[model samples]
Target: MNETFKPGPEAVEIVERESCFRGFYRLDRLRLRHRLFAGGMGPQISRELFVRHDAVCVLPYDPQRDAVVLIEQFRVGAMDKAANPWLLELVAGLIDTDEEPEQVAHREAEEEAGLQLGALWPITGYFPSPGGSDEFVHLYIGRCDSQGAGGVHGLAEEGEDIRVHVWPLEDALQAVKDGRINNAASIIALQWLALNRAEVRGLWV
Candidate 1:
């Protein structure tokens, strides 16, 4: 903890909140005021935030082959900004009320990639876009056999059409560097593995 970092929930005062929309997802408008760093309270501000469920994202890694599993799927939100809206990403799913984060990781691994995970390593968690969204992502590195781990798999009823890919660790990192892997969760997970590969391999192998 740094001494200069002192921001907390206590610093914010919520004056009012209203539900703006509710569907598969949610949106809320909040009227609030926050304590200023230099002196006193700041002016009231109104902001609409995207309310989302916390999700678990796992990078299925095979230490034996030094490879990783990635999934490709269509993203409507990125349709405008991305060269291709169908982007490569990690296996992920929202945490259900009856399940834990690790459970969701394992289930999503099987659902999205058709692979079973072993020896899960908790990496880190973060908010993808705190400015307008309250979506938090729990990241992990799940050990698995990447041999012959490429194919198309997803639950059709859920409107999911996914393509699974197994890439060598070097090539995957290169994808990250070349900006091919653009999603936040996948990028963070891969970069974390890049920084701590040896430690993770030592622990799993």
Candidate 2:
């Protein structure tokens, strides 16, 4: 939800009840302080949310082959929001309490695509959705063998049914433009690859 509010000494009311559901990710129910205008000062408002989430997205670049591995799955959140349920996304997962982002990336790659990562090229460490959630994703481009290591793979117990595809680097970028790939992480990863394709391809996969 794209919302804007103004800040003043005005009082805010919890017009509705707030609740939270804790799962792999937590959902927070909020009744805004009130809808006040920022008065042309730009949208400025603070939230009471303080969540810490660690995630990783694998680019899965293959230098010699000029390919990348990606996974497709049905996203419930998107369906709930009236968006397309099936989504093309990068290999990603939330970091458990003790795991590092890099380790999570590698682990997710194997779990979702059955590929072993070679070298990892880290992009940036930032928040994915900051307004309401304290979620953050640690982005990385990992080199891996994409010859015959990609296809359908996922943990059935987790209700995950993922389809892995080994895509030519250029075709993947084209898919991004054509809206065939419609997930934030996937879009960002592809754009990053577009800008750094030469350098990424120079490295051994």
Candidate 3:
């Protein structure tokens, strides 16, 4: 794969920007223009972007038990489209302060699953929905003991009612295959583990 076409941030032009909403989550309407593929400036396009702080999601894996820890919680956004609004997801939290992504990952692991992570392996980072949202997610696979992982744990002040579940690696992958695990970060982390489990286990050992 030898290619030489790269466009940087300098290629985009921000003409105007205005705040659309300023609540828990923010929405910004932007008027911008970018260089077209044919080598010219495109027309100014106006779009609303959902702005959110960066977040971290960790797939807590217990290699000794060959199991993974997951959390179940209610999601309002999926209420209309999903059969059940309560979803099985990886331990995740937003970077609300000056804490680093690794710190958020560890903190969320304790808060959501009541487990302490061991070795942490960075999987990848991505924008869940770049077309409309600027929510960047840093994903990781964290080592943990799943024996005592299941329970109802969450911060009451945050309105979180989370149930922890420990699933065998095979079962988790099956859920991913059958659409049971539909969250983007969870799906990506599970699939990545499925492909790299041997290497990860070796490293952990």
Candidate 4:
């Protein structure tokens, strides 16, 4: 490891923060200044931040069959980015207040794909967009019995319209290569599985 010094949260100064908008989610404007690499603090600047509950994404992998479960749903953010707004993604949901990420992972898998997960393997946690959002995502690979995992599933109360697909693990990885699996959480989970498939299977055993 490099012996370079790294700054921590104490390095940044928050001059002011206020809510700009709040509805289903929130937008906040912040005036902040941070320590510069050379020596002193940089000039204060304002930036808009998107604030939301942290999220959990679980990729259901069946070591027995070497398959993975995925879901398709419409994402408003992709309206202008992709030809089709519907994206193939992993099972995911925001962590409700007081809800643990493990619980969200299990609940989302069941709600979005009609699959039950057992023995989850933590993949990673990250900020999907650190520059604009404080939203952090926890990623996991859950072991499942994909004997007959397929079809449409999701809660009607939340207006969720999800279609489930069970594919050979290789095919799912191919989707990432082909740009079909475009979401950050899904891509990260799938790539992690690809690199550690055998190791994950060993853990299940």
Candidate 5:
């Protein structure tokens, strides 16, 4: 790391950009170059970037019951590499225009799992993929009452048919170890819970 060479948006220069595809999601072609770590700017190159709205994901955990609510959905993106395309994931939704990330978390939890979440604990915010996609995610663990939080719920108009699952906290963690819960956001949240379960429980209980 250089003392004066800071890494920021200004370090990258977008020479030219054009929309490549736009439908549900978007794609853009960019010719760009950026400041190099060793010395000067890297060579100008072409790249196709996947464009998507910033999104939010919340894992609903019941501190009293020591359980977590997760959802299973068909992910077309995973079809090529995964043995089973349906992924067990946190309740998630895109941050709509004028909608706060926390609001999206609460809304998706109810929409996908029938659970009205309590106070949301910030887990971490990250880019699920930065190499090729502009998909930033805000992750959270929302305290909830998971008394009856299992179902098949999703918006039909959006063609979503999601299956909700309530797992004991340990089981969810084990699923991650067993490679069952392979999605990035879910993996990150569950790992964080595994490390900070007691403190997180104290936040609600």
Candidate 6:
């Protein structure tokens, strides 16, 4: 793919940032020291209130049969916008301060999808919503046996009622067109798989 957006000519520095709260998650109020721009001149950019987080999403692929595993859960964020708040999504979770992103992907797969992930392959690392939230998601694709994947398993303490769904590559691709798989991470994962299906499937056997 051709490059869409290149980096700006320059960036400003953050003079200081203070934490408003440091309970479970810390919230910060930032102040920028200087400003700069791209293409000779641009608007003054300010730095403030950037929420930092580490997240992971997995695209579970069955290389032998060319399939994928997905999970369906009720998303509170989408509840207000969607007619059906319950959404079908890829397995994902936040990386704790003590845990690595790959480890988080493995744990979430077992907790949410009841499958073991093999050879964690990093797809990309990016910010899902940079304009408002400082959340960064590390995306991955893990090989698995999709034939026998079953059951609904979720964390009882977290009240997660997630159902696992094993899907062939074609069916999941259709879900994207039908507007069923709506989330950004999930959508990106599927599209990536679609592009690289043949190579991915050749790995297991």
Best model number under lDDT: 3
**Candidate 3 CA-lDDT value:** 0.93
Residue 140: error of model 2 in Å?
A: 0.6
Every model's TM-score: 0.95, 0.77, 0.96, 0.95, 0.95, 0.84
Q: Candidates sorted by lDDT, descending order?
A: 3, 1, 5, 4, 6, 2
Residue-by-residue lDDT tens digits, candidate 6, 1-205: 2244345424445557787777646778766543322233334455455576688999899888778899999989998899998898889998766999989999999999999999877888888877656889999998888878978889999999999999888999999999988999999989988887777767655
What's the true lDDT of residue 65 in model 3? 82
- For residues 1-205, write the lDDT of model 3, one tens digit per residue: 2134347898899999999899989999999998776677789999999999999999999998889999999999999999999999999999989999999999999999999998789999999999999999999999998886788999999999999999999999999989999999999999999999999888776
Question: Per-residue lDDT for 65-105 in model 5, tens only?
Answer: 89999899999989999999999999999976799999999
lDDT of 1 at 196: 95
What TM-score should be assigned to candidate 3? Answer: 0.96
Error of 4 at 13 (Å): 1.5
Better of 2 and 4 by lDDT: 4
Per-residue C-alpha lDDT of model 4 across residues 1-205, encoded as one tens digit per residue? 2234358898899999999999979999999998777767889999999999999999999998889988999999999989999999989999867889999999888989998899888899999899999999999999999988888899999999999888999999898999988889888898888889888888785
Worst 10 residues of 2 by lDDT: 38-47
Window of ten residues with lowest summed lDDT in model 3: 1-10
**RMSD, model 5, all Cα superposed?**
1.4
Candidate 1: give the clashing pairs. none
Task: Return the top candidate by TM-score.
Answer: 3
lDDT of 2 at 119: 82
Model 5 stretches astray by more than 4 angstroms: 1-3
> What CA RMSD would candidate 6 show?
4.2
Question: What is candidate 4's CA lDDT for residue 88?
Answer: 95
- C-alpha lDDT values of all predictions: 0.91, 0.79, 0.93, 0.90, 0.91, 0.82
